[model samples]
Target: MSIKYKFHDPGAIYFVSFAVVGWIDVFTRSVYSDILLESLTYCRKEKGLNLHAWVIMSNHVHLIVSSREGYLLSDIMRDLKKYSSFRIVKEIRESTIESRKEWMLYLFAKAGQQNSNNKNFQFWRQDNHPIELDPHLNMFEERIDYLHNNPVKAGWVTNASDYLYSSAIDYEGGKGLIEIDLLV
Candidate 1:
């Protein structure tokens, strides 16, 4: 995995994306999305993640993140993916109000079967697609814009800051759901 998604610079900010298996709309429900948010909060508080920007879409999440306090970015990514996958899959399985439970489980199960790494269900895809953001090239700002505008482009909201599941609100000078380290 390190060969594919290399985090060479320990202190450099990276724009990373990880998607659900089959691009399933798993986050249409607030429960699953909230689980992810909670896990992110845990990671930030306990795992030394320096989160600069983030957006959670229906099928994937975009993050501009780094590591601090001697933490490796790759290790943080691994733990985040592992924990979130387990919690989200468990929530989906146990949710009584989830109308598409059976179908969703089938899809996840099929994805797991295709991947030898997963035991039963594969919630998140293996690739994080981490792109190291170079401040000299202004790639950080560009990716932040793209990340915030994802909800707007998907027609979920007319304005990026109007979306609740993103750090756009933080960028706009309002407190967002998840506390983030502001990008200066």
Candidate 2:
């Protein structure tokens, strides 16, 4: 029932990043990313969320998003995080695809049990440091470029659009994994 931080200003553009707990590479596989996509899709359709840009890296997510009808961005992010954590954990624990990763997950799970009141592993970092996009402060373009070039910067792919989990392609030519609301 606590009010989210982004609720204070409904019309502000926010660039937010949420890292995985322990920065584990939970999203190196598409399982967790798929869950994130599903949750985002639901939020966008049901709650009138405006997604400006997004990038799902190995252990973190960068999003340039706003909302419609006074919807709170923080609440939407919280829902996405919660749902992805649940679905990904369940998937990881049962799937043979992630079975060989037992030790890493066990450690993550133990950390979660210790950190949270729940009995399962946690997925995302608790702190969501959303920087308000202010063109005056000169951070807006920096964040946008960072999100677009992250995969390329990481050497995962030569072109930003080559990363299948990012919105760079959507910006370039609409060949992205998901629909994007072009900011410009």
lDDT for residue 113 in candidate 2, whole number 0-100: 76
lDDT value, candidate 1, whole model: 0.90
Residue range 1-184, candidate 1, lDDT tens digits: 2225589999899999999988999988888889999989998999989999999899999999999969998888889988999999898899898888999899999988888777798888887668999899989789999999999999999999999999998998899998999886
lDDT of 2 at 32: 71
Best-performing candidate as measured by TM-score: 1
Error of 2 at 50 (Å): 1.2
Q: Number of clashing pairs, model 1?
A: 0
Q: Candidate 2's C-alpha lDDT?
A: 0.79
Model 2 agreement with the true structure over 1-184: per-residue lDDT tens digits? 1223454577888898888777888788887788888888888898677888899999899998888876777777777777877877778777886754687677668767777445667667776667788768767667878999999999999988888999888877766777767776
